[model samples]
Target: MAWSADKSYFFMLAKLLTYSIFGIDARPVEVEVDISPASMPKTILVGLAEAAVKESTHRIERALVNSGYTRPVDRIVINLSPADFPKEASSFDLPIALGVLAASGQLETSLFSEYSAVGELALDGVVRKVRGALSMALQARANGKKGLIVPVENSREAAVVDGIDVIPVGSLAEAVGFYTGVLPIDPVPFSWDDAVEEHGTYPFDYSDVKGQEMAKRAVTVAAAGRHHLLMIGSPGTGKTLLAQRLGTILPPLSAEESLETTRIYSAVGRLEEGESLLLQRPFRSPHHTISQAGLVGGGSIPTPGEISLAHHGILFLDELPEFNRNTLEVMRQPLEESRVTISRAVGSVTFPASLMLVSAMNPCPCGYRGDPKRQCHCSPMQIERYLSKISGPLLDRIDIHIEVPPVPFRELSARTEGTRSETMREQVIVAREAQRERFGKDGSLVNGTMAPQQIRKYCKLSKEAESLLKAAMEEMGLSARAHDKILRVSRTIADLDQAEFIDVPHLTEAINYRTLDRSSWTQ
Candidate 1:
């Protein structure tokens, strides 16, 4: 790591701390730069850097001269540490420029070791935004660095992690001046309340819909317990509309959950500039034609899929039966495990998939089979073919299966509106608080994620409730998974009612939610 400045003295600037993002986590990287007198002046990158990272030499050269620094007339060698693993994109430009300056004696700073820098450099010296700034900041804090120097636009996002200073620089000259004590720029402060208070409301609301009280109630229960829901109804019913507004009724994300969710979005470069953090629960609805790799994560680089993008939020699949059966089937494991692992030739990465699933579909192929006003044209075989697309295993994994019947004309014509989202959100929050006390400080964890041990412990049923469940199981031929789902839904129902034990009415209501499960859908 030694460089000759004037053939008289050797300079060394090694172990410049930085980070590289892989999947959702950041891996620490040390950058080393050396400039030595040679026959010809050329830049070469070593240590298994990718093509995009290797091409930063030209960018760094042009940026230095534009920012009023002389390009060194010597052979330059920039090495990214841990040579075994390959580095990705243009995030290394600023770091490489800084390394060249630090190594060639053009920039001298005593506090260089205390700061970590990452940004894409424009040929005109303007520092551009890079992906995973939040992840890099979190890694810097975890690695005991004093501060992070990132693009000006990403300062707030990197500042979400406390106990570290986020130094935002607009250009390479600003960064160089700050490191060399030529400029003094204060770090911006981040406020959790400010993000929440300033965030605007979603355009849709519960009050906009007419009369699907049953579907609304099922959504409330699903929101209360984080349970997955499936709605079967005619096409004109408000099932899709209800699913869209489900995020409105769920509780606001916790501060930790907000940051965690923001990190994932940031890793994928999905966070828009000026948006600090994801303050609300996410609602992701992929089209029915999405591939398995797109639904789950896959590729040589293995970026996040739709499930990972929906972490700590809602994943709505509208027109459920229209999706490929294989695509629908792949969700079963992640639904139970709350995470998906994508393995490639290089390695494996596990992305968080802990989300509430809400799916809606028509009762038959014609969409008017069960409607009172519309005449049915499709035969029973056609209806069976349509319903058969949704497998039993997937249905068994879903907890609540309520039929969203078409709204009656009388109910739709009434002047009065049904319950609003605010009231339902309040109820959900109360239930969530109770569950937080029950499951400890992890308020994000809910009854829906409980294992068998937890189910046996917290979801205790009374003697009468147990007898009723036994009779229902005998008559309906429910599987062991279905039985446990019933218990889980009953526990959530009880939590909503503020009851200590699962009562008969709670169990009965929970059983009623399993309409598709007990019917001939499986057959």
Candidate 2:
């Protein structure tokens, strides 16, 4: 049970599997520990480890002695390979500790090669949760590892990743007992069906808003097709309310999407302890005072920004004009590419940012420019300056632009609710199913994400629809990008109507959404 010279290390070497998260994905690493009795009585951690691991060997020694094991009296060396890359996470602590115990003959274990382990260690030898446990489990499964040993708090999160066993350990002693076959451990239970049973439940619903049927319709279309939307209105017109409830009408994330999204959340350490797969789509509403780096993701070691956090979900910008122009402008590339690439001097990382951008802004600076109840106090210059903050190119990227009118007093006080989120959610689901069928083979997810090439193939228009779109383009001074957006929106309208072809009515309805393109707005 204690350290013995006969059972002690002669050819003492131990290597185990571990993982490191880079951006939103993970890569496997091998933790190798070497123990030499004849060398100096010191511990050294080498091979490009970060500052956090500088005292790792010392901590491992302390943890070993504290966990009722004799500390190795000889020299110690720990190396995490691939040695060329930077290792910065605290996940290396567990593997390093186990490797030392095995190499020092305190623990007779050979499961290190069969199982991957990731966790931080306390001086008292307790195993603390590490970030990206789910990501590590996935890497372990992909690399043909049989099982994963993680902190007890992370068992549920990593257990959801199928095809591998998850051994939850509470302390370093418990982990050593399991590895040495001195104790028993069970893998946690998690399933996809159990994760998605509570999908459509939401605290905010469309029925909460009295009037704004047009705004609801526009938002439904945007969700159905993954389109970006902009709502221009005065204060207290349900614009913010509508934006908040957009995700309620969206379908739950698919199994593949759930894994991908959960991995992203895990990598960022945003996932709560013991939480499994994230079935609900994310809805991120960042403040207007955010900077370019926070909005688009940039740092010494890059991190995911708000857009990436809102992946496969909505990014709502309320009071859009209040945001700094350059900060808002950072979204132009990700809007087109559905991904963000942040480059550092050492390396570059790319984060997925596929999301529905729903922004709301007042009609003017005073918030009463077009209100029938309130008088406008701002001059034309102030209005122009506020509107100018949002660039034309940026506006063109958005598919739908509509005005939210003030709700009537009777509508506000009426007991009878208008259309509810349940009704709209069903309709949106139907329309999205239609799009999934239409773009099944071409690899396009939604009409709004279609490129010009996919647009030419799937968004075919009838003659009547073509003529209407042409006249409206000329009258509104629409750009080519705007033209494509209208076509995409029109395609979505047809999908909503359950029609196969884009008819003239769908085209008219789509063109009507481009309210900012009209010359009267400028006048």
Candidate 3:
């Protein structure tokens, strides 16, 4: 028999469903296999398969033989449909092998219609776990798949997605048995409320720090407003400690936010084994030596970077001045847009980066520029040159700039518990509730991300507060952006105070946050 373009001939070809990951998304691919007796006995894999995908044939052959299935000797042609798109990952091994069995008349083709499978096959028929199981499960549900066949290790990750059965298979033999109705594997069980209650709590707290009440207060304001914060202080002034506890004071992650954050972590293979949903907010602190691509997400395939992993969470850049200037500058766009878009020659990928940027740095090169106890050894020119590494534009984008002075010996030795995270979180929840009512229940709009028009509409100021802002703007030589920032921060402060309008005290606190940029150290 010869191959023809006739529609009726398509019925003889065996096709199974699978998926390929494309920038944190799972795109459906049909594994279409055809065995032609007219051609030589060789297997040909098409549809732009990458090296990893192309190399799976040998593994699949051994897996099939070990799983008690015959390896097809006829001229086998496997075409991953949507032929123009590039396909990667060894997850194609299972689906291609199954398609081969069906096309060779060893298995019923109709059984594959109910499920879409993704897994890597070992030589002895074991099925290995692959990345992006959560995204694949979501896509499978969207496409009306009855279930998704995944490795046992990925069962929990994929099962978190509702409305689809996740069939956990430990080996190629088990997968075949389940599809053939000879074996039954139940969908993994998940209780959303139970998972949240178990993993939602943070181990650290604000009270864990000995002192620095002022820093704690400033951090509360920043968290309440979702504002970027920059803490300047001497070494060991508890900058890192303050930054680490910021998450404990933040509101817990909503279900939607958890799914979004989990998808990024899943796509990057960062999820721990057997972990289903990420209940707590993510806290990503990339080292200062990270590259621009590593910070914002870029590759030939354009995977999600540190910022994307920190979606709806915190991105702490400790020792901020040590980071490359270009790498730090790359954050300007994502910070403004709440998303990072990486454009590759193949395509463009946009990743969510709606996160709180918390960073820490020493005041100067010697790490004691403003310390009362330590003698300053660095020359003024050296201090000036060191501070210049952080450009003015970047500084202006940060909403709150506060100095974290060293804790006094008396304060450190005090047995009293400092401010607790629970107390600050109550304040943050109240302030966030106010923003929700003001911005509507959409949960996307906050004071820190307010547009100019929104600021004009919502930020009402008292006459005295207006006068104070004008004087500060003049004395500090603030830019138009800085002016809007003051208004936003003022609006947040007023919310924290439960005040309806911005008053003198609120405006004064907001104005003081901007003073570090105008400090004499820069002069």
Q: Considering every candidate listed, which one attains the maximal lDDT?
A: 3
Q: Which tens-of-lDDT digit does each residue in 1-523 have in candidate 3?
A: 2332332232147888999998999999999988886567898999999899999988999889988887765688989998877888888998998888777666664568889999999999899999899999999999999999999999988999989999999998888888888888899888988887777778899998989998998999999999999999999999999989888989888889999999999998898776788888898999999999999999888899999999999999998999999999999989999999988877889999999999999988989887999988989888888888998878878999989999999999999999999999999999999999998866788899999899999999999999988988787877778889989999999999999999999999887787565645476
What is the C-alpha lDDT profile of model 1 across 1-523, one tens digit per residue? 4545456444565458788888888888888887766537888899788888978889899999999987877777888988877788688899889988888777888776899999999999999988899999999999999999999988889988899999999999999999989999898799888878776367778987899887888899999999999988888799888988888888777787788889889998888778889987888999999999999888777788899889988899988999999998999999988899988776788998889999988888888866889987988888888988999889877899888888899988999978899989998988888899999866557988888998999999999999999999999877778899999999998998999999999999999998776756534
lDDT of 2 by residue, 1-523 (tens): 2333565445378889899877777878898888877777778788788888776767777888889988777778888898867778888989899888887776777788788899999998999988888889988999998899999988888998878999999899999989988998988888677666644256788899898898889988898898999999999888889988887899877787777777888888898654687877888999999999989888776888999989888899999999999998999999999999999865899999988999999988899987887999988898898899999878878899999999999989899998999999999999998988887775447899888898999888999989988888787788777889899999999999999899999999898898888878865
Clash-forming residue pairs, model 2: none
Give the higher-TM-score candidate: 1 or 3.
3
Sort the predicted structures by TM-score, highest score first: 3, 2, 1
RMSD of 2: 2.3
Q: How displaced is residue 445 in candidate 2, in Å?
A: 2.7
Model 2, C-alpha of 217: deviation from truth (Å):
0.8
- Please give the TM-score that candidate 3 achieves against the real structure: 0.96
- Per model, state how many residue pairs clash: 0, 0, 0
lDDT of candidate 3?
0.89
State how far residue 514 of model 2 sits from its true place (Å). Answer: 0.6
TM-score each candidate: 0.94, 0.95, 0.96
lDDT of each: 0.87, 0.86, 0.89
